[model samples]
Target: MVSQSAFAFICCLSLLLTFAHCKTLKRDVKALNEIKASLGWRVVFAWVGDDPCGDGDLPPWSGVTCSSQGDYRVVTELELYAVSIVGPFPTAVTNLLDLTRLDLHNNKLTCPIPTEIGRLKRLRTLNLRWNKLQDVIPPEIGELKRLTNLYLSFNNFKWEIPKELANLPELRYLYLHENRFTGKIPAELGNLPNLRHLDVSNNHLVGTIRELIRVEGSFPSLRNLYLNNNYLTGGIPAQLANLTNLEILYLSYNKLSGTIPSGLVHISKLTYLYLTNTSKALGLMERARLSLFKHFPYQAEYHLVPYLGRPLLRTNHSATLPHLTSSRPNMWRFSLWRFFTR
Candidate 1:
């Protein structure tokens, strides 16, 4: 029953496997240690010891997430969100080459995002929102070909929104709102076929909204588009009606002029259309038509009512149109209720 030769061979193979495992584990441990040190290790005291990946299914560190890769486990995610970790962008993350999700949102991290972030080619979700980080976004971020969700909102980031972001073919959600970002929205962004939610609202953006319509099937899958509280000018594009899946459209507090596109009513899925205080130039007749659509599903807020210092449709007065008077009394009440409440 005791075959020394086979037993020795098995033992040797086991040692080799252990060695390989240690090599991979050590690399991740070193990187994590560096991150802890950079962010002040006292804050992440739970990240103690040399094995951040832990012994079995659980990780030794608080925010570390690992997955088995052959004989060894590798760190795949590091969610240190809202942990009060302060300092510059933790450059040590670049060392975790296998990391797929890096969420450090709501931190006190400062300085520009490191270009070394590009090395994490496997990153899918990078959530750095609500941080104190500043400076322009690194163009190297476009190197993350597999990225899907990128949230850099509510930061102090300035300069033009990076056109390089168009390189992410897999991107779905991109939030860069409430930043100091200026310049026109990148026309290249409209080319992303799978992008579903894009919010660049409350920035200093200017120029015509036409940049987004440069591509034929622009924002083909977009659902919620927020471009409000900016200095954007020119008419609302009729092509926007092509976003048949769009549900919430916010174009308020801008200098947009010209007739409200009639094609907008055709977007049957649209539920919320916010055009409050857009421009005084919008035709009163056109505004009245938008407010009175019988089939319009959700509340629509136009600049026509109180902002223009008069009621758009005075159903009680002689000024009420023949069409308005002839309409079912219930339909008129319903339309007025939705318009005024908004």
Candidate 2:
């Protein structure tokens, strides 16, 4: 049996250890409070406590995810997707240096992303899609060396796509479509070695696709590339056929003018191709026509037909074609069949 003084001392030490191991770091708690206050009264009701990290099993707050780091807990993820969060980007998030993912998509968040976002060096995914956020993307996003996925689509963002994004060495998926961006597509984007999917469609981008082609070994691992609904001119680069892993290509609704490249037929993995409303001068070369039929003899047929007061060449491959139709005249629609697979 222990003396009263020794028993009391043991109890006190156990209580101290419990309190130390259960509480979130003071800085992280402060940041969480600031984020809640910045988000106005629409924040989650569970955000009511001084200990947002809870008792180490789950976070007390709804959107916050915390992890243990020695004696304290730290915020690691904040996924408030489609929560109707109103107001600007929460600037306090930069304080969470250990954050690996930040998703605030499908909100009413407005204004430009703060440059302090670069402070989250451990971030691997940053998704801000389907928001009202406007203004040019900050170049500091390039500082996230571990970023693998970036989705900024369906926003009101304007101006040129930042070329600094090329600095992200591990980036894989880059989606900037359905925005109001203007200026030339950054050719530096083509040099991303690990990039798999790139979509810049439905913007005001101008200039030729030749810049991307000039970079040797561009888009080596690319599988899906979307450059539709822009003001791009010049011929389609035949070097695009070099993307052996490419499965889908969208270059429609642009001002491109040139004959279709016959080498595209050699891309055996290409399952879907779109070239609608490209230009009035765009046509399929005779070699390209023969190549298409050679690869897809049963389903591929090219012929000119009168439609919408213009002659249009349509290729029908019903087996693999999606239910897509274009009313615009002077367009070439090719529904290539995935007849061969690698």
Candidate 3:
């Protein structure tokens, strides 16, 4: 049998090895820091310091989820959309390696989206909406074969939708709204068999919305269709009626003047119909908005947003406004999952 001193030495070695491994992950975080730093996105993501992963028996970090067993390697999902963080996206994000979802919306972040983002092989949902982002979307983004939902709305993007985006076999929700994109919606989008929500609203998109609608089968999963506020001409395709699952339709504020398709208004699941600037009606002023917001009872995953620059709703205006137009509180959010599978 080993002497007690020898046993203690072995234990010390094992502890040292474990500590070294944990420190390695810190290197990964620092790599991310560098990427986020240069791009200015570190400003929005700076809350990383507030993370409580080291707390005993608990790990609470906003927009982050972790695996339940073993060392609990980060099967992380970062959903910080509309969190008001600003700055550029960095190549270091691909370093997270285990990340499945990344949502960064409504921040003031500016710069070209790095092509390296496509290197995130495990990524699932990627939403970068309502930021000041400008530049061409990298065709390399198609490399995200596992990608499901992709939102790139309200930025200053000006490029043809890459034909490669259709290669994302798992793609479901695709939003390219309110940008400067100027091109025909590629017929290849129809190749995305699992596509559900397709919104290309408020862009400079031109030409007929294409004939892929006649492909003889319904995109059973397809739901909301938002093609509003564009220069797209030509009649609304009757083939659109075949999509039995079609729901919200926003065709207002476009050059398309054809009669509304007969079955459209009556689609069984169709709800929250929006038209020219109708969604702008959803922005309620301060007191009125806060009234709808019940204080979050438990600890929040994300830090509380400051009142400064937060949208305020006027109580008087809310009373007069049509309640039908308002969005559900934090409609873009999904439930937090405590148990993650790696």
Candidate 4:
């Protein structure tokens, strides 16, 4: 039984409240501006206007997204992948408290990652690959409890990988390849329950590679493991057989010794196996040849490259296992028939 004037007044107040709530905050705009300034002009362009989170139909900026936050709009995502941006990783990004995904990979960015990156607690994905970043990864990165995908590969990083990386429980993919990391692979890496892909290849890593197998029931979900071209010395642990879900394994160009554990042959899921240049790797190669030849599909590839001082096949290299070493397409055809018929 309200009057028309009273009802209209209430409706007007609701419209005013909605208008105030949809506007972008001044702090978010400031953070975005700082990030652009850090990247310089050459890489980031078309950011001339001040209203980044505009009230228009299109997005405010080139690589920015805005979302509602109480009575204000805030930046939720900032993606600048392969945009040829130069300069160091922007520290001002930490100011965007609502940011969930930050992709600045495949650019010419230089300098070490900022330590304040740990402040982005809500971040789930952070990609900074193919850059010129160097120095050791900041231990503070472990603070990203919500991080799921972390890519820092193809950089100039040196020094031992921080053990703190194991602190990220939700981490699934970790790529730190083609860097200058030294020291034993951290045993703590096995602590990651959800880890599926781990690649630390082509680095100067030293010490035995058994640390990854030390933890019981570790890496139960691991699918791909690549630790090739390191200075690793020691026997390949039989525990690797426990990773029943393992699909691709690369442990080449190392100084490892001891007979290849027969348990590895039982891993039915393993398809791509590369054990080139490791001591006594031929033992497993020869033993598993029959099983692999009979069980695996044509798509599976096994490379047992001969190293110096120990040549598995010499002089008659062209004749030895001609079917196995032939053109890849032909080999796949041969292997397919051999596996099904036998």
Candidate 5:
């Protein structure tokens, strides 16, 4: 009795598999309605109509996340930071081929950043910081080799600093500070051996911090090297005491000169040393008999105290201070909790 041509051949194979699952959920709802009409459609994209990946009764759109795949959905994650999405940066958001996290940092975004965004090869974390993004950082974003954390700070980018970001072999936190960038600084970013916190401080970068620590193993897991207020001059590079896991060394207001390098105060992991705004343009004297605290190998390491002036007169009161005044003890104003409690 059930042979009406085998139930009309199982109803034409369940209507051709539900018309190919509504044609892959209507092509991920037409690429999320072309990124909500290229980021101009507000009212939170009007609840992105027509069942956007939340069918069991419909819910998903707003900041759009969607998941499933074989059954439908798609658009992985589009955070949309700061709401007020103005325009420009929406190159149809690389058409959501399973986007991995494209947070459009602090909106009001202007132009530039579209070198087709290195086609987002599953981008890791690319927050376009404080937008208004001007030209030149797209050396195809080093083709996002699964980028780690690239926040283009303050924006209005002026170019230069892109030595193809050393092909991002898993880049770790690279914020291009205060943008208006100029030349030098790119000693291939010390070949990014998993760079850790490298801020190109206050740009107008001039060079000669010996291309940043003369490049040996270079920034080997660097811990916070800001290169303060650029226009940088010479003389702080005793290979920066080879950044022995440096801990906060800003190099304040640049135009740096000599002295301060007694192997950089024995970098037993310095705790905040800004080089006293370059001791009044390196007039840092006291080298006649060469004893920057006898290169501290320990004599209780000169009673370790001065961070802003007071305790360091113990080589038996080191001949009663005053070798070049400026009120002595300015080992660049210490006190970063006395180098992590001794």
Candidate 6:
């Protein structure tokens, strides 16, 4: 009788939970419709937990995640990439008090992003790239205190980057390339404690690029930086050399003038380089001083087969060299080469 009573009690609790879950789902769907209407012609195949009347698996529906017991109170993540969705940023997501991640990248999303997005307290990754988003980035975005990866590239966004972004204590990767953003890079941007990759290229931004290199004192975790195709007109910032982990650099198609910063001589870890069409002289920026391979005690050797066709450096020099610089089938015919070999 005790076991039977316990089973009946558990069954009663489950029924109550199902009722509560259905109620929450109805509320969430009502909220989503507001966003969908603003989207107009844009359509997304999004799954938010499940349609309360869904015929299949209830939990794994398009943009929906569920609680362990299949309840509806917990909303975990929203990844809506490449969905071809259009129109303004959705503000109804604020109602999902428990949503952790929100991604709507590679879509046709338009209009200024809603400032209410800061409500996603647990949001860790927010990707809104490859959209038609315009206007100045809202400062309220800094309120997503837990953000890690932020992708806002390929849009018509303009004006100064919001300095309030420095408030994000855990921000890591930020990609804002190919936009209409103008003005100097914010000084406070250097204060982001965990910033790693920053790509703000292909914009109309003007002014010096120094503050972004070592804004406060150092850039311990920064790696890749792409600021090409802009109106940045000045000497390369010397502090940029302090970024030891920098591997890839693209500064082409800018109005930047003056010689490359001498500090670049010490950046030996760089593997990819693109510094063409700038007012800065090219010859001076070719080489970087590296820890001598021989002196580095037992360093691992990463050998590459000789690349004789094109210079590994991505420069304006690719056209000048014959197909192969080291040797060509025609080079053997020279009498001077035969005599030197003998």
TM-score of each: 0.81, 0.82, 0.63, 0.80, 0.34, 0.70
CA-only RMSD, every prediction: 7.3, 8.6, 14.7, 7.5, 17.7, 9.9
Query: Whole-model Cα lDDT per candidate?
Result: 0.78, 0.78, 0.61, 0.76, 0.69, 0.64
Q: Considering TM-score, which of the candidate structures 3 and 4 is the better prediction for this target?
A: 4
TM-score of 5: 0.34
lDDT of 6 by residue, 25-121 (tens): 5555655556555655435344344342232344444555544324544556666677677667787877665667777888888899888887777
lDDT of 4 by residue, 1-342 (tens): 999999999998987557544878888889888887777776557676665676444347887877777878888889888888877788888888788899888998778898989988988998888999989899999999999999999999999999999999999999999999998889889889899999999999998767767877888889999998899888879898989988888887777776557677567767666666554333344554564454433443333334434544342233233233322342222111111100
Per-residue lDDT over 166-201 for candidate 5, one digit per residue giving the tens place of the 0 to 100 score: 889888889989999998788777778888889989
**Lowest-scoring 10 consecutive residues by lDDT in candidate 2?**
333-342
Q: Write the per-residue lDDT of candidate 3 for residues 92-211, one digit (tens) a residue.
A: 677677678887777776887888887789999888888988888989899999999898988999977777988998999998988889888776777778999998887888786445
Q: What's the true lDDT of residue 119 in model 4?
A: 87
User: Positional deviation of 277 in candidate 5, in angstroms?
Assistant: 10
> Of the candidates numbered 2 and 4, which has the greater TM-score value?
2
Report the error of model 3 at residue 308, Å.
44
Query: lDDT of model 2 at residue 321?
Result: 21
lDDT of prediction 2? 0.78
Q: After superposition, how far is residue 8 of candidate 2 from its true place, in Å?
A: 33
Clashing pairs for model 2 are none
Off by over 4 Å in 2: 1-20, 55-59, 284-292, 295-342
Off by over 4 Å in 1: 1-24, 55-59, 285-304, 308-342
Clash totals in order = 0, 0, 14, 0, 2, 6
Residue pairs with clashing backbones, model 1: none
lDDT of 2 at 221: 86
lDDT per residue, candidate 2, 288-332, as tens digits?
344444543223323333223433344341322223233322223
